[model samples]
Target: MDPTDTAVMIENYEAFRSEISLSKEDVIRELFRQNQDRISIKKEATAVRNLIRIIDSTLRLANSKGFHAMTLRDLCADSGLSMGGLYAYIRNKDDLIHLIQNHGFIITRRTLLHYTRDVPDVRDRLYAAIKAHLYLSELMRAWFYFSYMEAKSLPPQEKRDAVAIEREIEAIFLGVIEAGIDAGVYQPRNARLVSSMIKALLQDWYLKRRKYLDQNVPVDDYAMFVRDVVESYLLQA
Candidate 1:
């Protein structure tokens, strides 16, 4: 099970993306269907469908205009939902941001854990983690973009939660590196520190994608490059 040098199917991010293929409607329903108390949105099929429209529109508008600059009226107009309907989803702008952030975290965290949970080898696990994260960020670029840029605007507790989420992701990478070290597949190093570096590189993929995209770097290319560099560093004598 030593994936340190042997050939294996290191497919593109698209392969990871396909494993968690979810439609827009499904995301909305899955996010809001549980918050009956917090969100007044009805649970009917059409209502759940419209909730997706509302979330999609809110994110779009919030991304275009700063979340602070986006008003309830703008959300209503963009989402094609009246104030009453919008209120059912969120009480105010703060609530709106909370809803969006929570939903994004749930999906991102779940996807990462699911795809990386079964990797038998630490090297393969690391590769899958990197590819899953990069592809998820690519597929939900707007969510990642909004979360990063607008994070400071969130309330103190919410901001803490955001940081915690980031650390949790880093911990996943840390676990894989530690496991590799334990199995003598990777050279010893500070696993946590190394994981943080890996997380930083992965974050840059979503944060400064324009720079990479300008150079015509594709996700698969970036994923493989990351895998190569990380594996090379880990396997050093």
Candidate 2:
């Protein structure tokens, strides 16, 4: 594929999906591995399956009724796991919050890096980064919404961790824009500001999805629209 050709470079959600594995099982497996010491479940397969249920139910409950208001009892009922079974995965609500936050961050960080890291053409890389975010958010809309909504209630350290995650993702975009400017593919401008704007645009899709869904706008279309808005300021005349 000619990376420089915008027409050819554009990719849809299906292409992004095939290239990246962000399934619930895939993410939960990684999550279980990362938190094995903390997760009392000894068996990988059982732990991963239960983690999926716990995480999915958490996102659903958190998005619907607010994370702070959600109880472990509610989680157990919602996920169809006994209280003892839920404890095998998470000790407390705070622990559950951390699990949710970390898993979402891990997936988001990995998705952006996977799509953009090896692409040589900066513009194509930027589009890939943008599309990766929008598509991933669309897939995990509840997680994204839950993370944003519950961030304020996070403990001091976890809140800082959440902020760091946002900056790290933004830095990925900044790196691409700076590369484009250095290569003269994009105009000389405030790359940092541009990156922040890009993040806000991407966040809007998940945060305000009701509005977009109300209009029946598809994610692929939203991806192209974001690329257009971003590239308009990026590309030189």
Candidate 3:
């Protein structure tokens, strides 16, 4: 699904807020000014929210198997919504795939934003980003795994957007590496390559968590392992 379609829906939903007697006229006017249309923003927002829920539930089910293994009937059952209702939110399975990919990016961006806020030093920011990313994956393990693995199946435009979001995330890691080098904290090397490696290490925990658990690895221990590797590789001499 095109993100703009969702955006337009959200804008329309916002416009619907004016129906409430308590809704401020000024607020509604501002929304109209920004959107240039008094569309049913409330309904659109609700539909978008439902769409996200559908994506989340479907991905959770798909993680046990794979995307191709999941049917629309499976999604309908998993999401606890009828086929008609589900279709109202999305055109088809392909649309749902796009929604899930975009939703993952939205969630990841929100998580990183919280971690990076108010952190001045680049090293601290990087630490916070890593911790946030790992913690979020642990908390939303199925969703993260589904997003990572199912991305390849998205349509060309959706795939490009997904890759762009992934690259942006890697750039955050690269920024830290570059900072470390500039501050004489890290050895001169390819920051992008190092960033990719760091991401792999972080992702491997959730993706292959069974292996780690079989070895009796605790979360704190896993986090410490990441910190140690990063510090050893990136810290100043």
Candidate 4:
């Protein structure tokens, strides 16, 4: 990735983390210690839910094209909401951008968490992680593509926040690689660089999948090819 692209990824990662942290804090404040009344808590929860739906729908659509190309009408049509209804949730396109970027990271992190549970062996864990990543891209192909392409259009602050979330996800991959090395299942290399390559492979599935499918490639077969490549390049002798 170029410097600008790298910066955006890091911002996405940070935004994701910050949103999670805020959400947790809000829940605790409202429910745990009863910092807020029941009515207020419920209202806040409802608002968050609506906002999430909008962001999720928007990200799913935006990834298929350049962010600049997506308009309010596009968002309205994709989300099945009126223009006024959309504005009630967000002030403008910039706010929508922040929401979509943050939502993408949050959804991705949740998916990874679910996929990583109860797997003890490092190699299996890494394989499972790659599988989960690929499966998610398949499932949320539109959102994945939208976040990758439209993230640059976000405001400076939001852009930085989004990059942070992206970096966090990358770090998770790097950690898996490092764990495999320590467990003697993989060879030592630059974990960051290898992680990037692995991510690229996964991203290419959504970004350039038509070519692969045009060649009559099945998802399982493609995943196996990726698994084999990682094994051949990174496995210990």
Backbone clash tally for model 2? 0
Reference-based TM-score of each model: 0.90, 0.91, 0.77, 0.73
Q: Write the per-residue lDDT of candidate 3 for residues 127-206, one digit (tens) a residue.
A: 76677677667766787888778677778887898789989988878887798789876888788988898899999998
Q: After superposition, how far is residue 130 of candidate 1 from its true place, in Å?
A: 0.1
User: Over the stretch 134-169, how does candidate 4's per-residue lDDT look in tens digits?
Assistant: 766776677777777666666898778778877877
Predicted structure 1, TM vs. truth: 0.90
Error of 2 at 79 (Å): 0.9
Q: Candidate 4 — what's its lDDT?
A: 0.65
Return the candidate ranking by lDDT, descending: 2, 1, 3, 4
Overall lDDT per candidate, in order of appearance: 0.80, 0.84, 0.66, 0.65
Give a tens-digit lDDT track for model 2, residues 1-237.
122223233368777666455355776788888888888889999998888888889888888887878899999999999998898888888889889898898888867776677788888899888987888888888988888887888988779999999999999999999999999999999999999999899899998888998999999989889989999988857
Give the true-structure RMSD of model 1.
4.6
What would the per-residue lDDT of candidate 1 be over residues 122-191, giving only the tens digit for each residue?
8889988888788888988888989999888898877988999998989989999999999999999889
Which run of 10 residues does model 2 get worst, by summed lDDT? 1-10
Instruction: Find the 10 residues in a row with the least total lDDT in model 3.
Output: 2-11
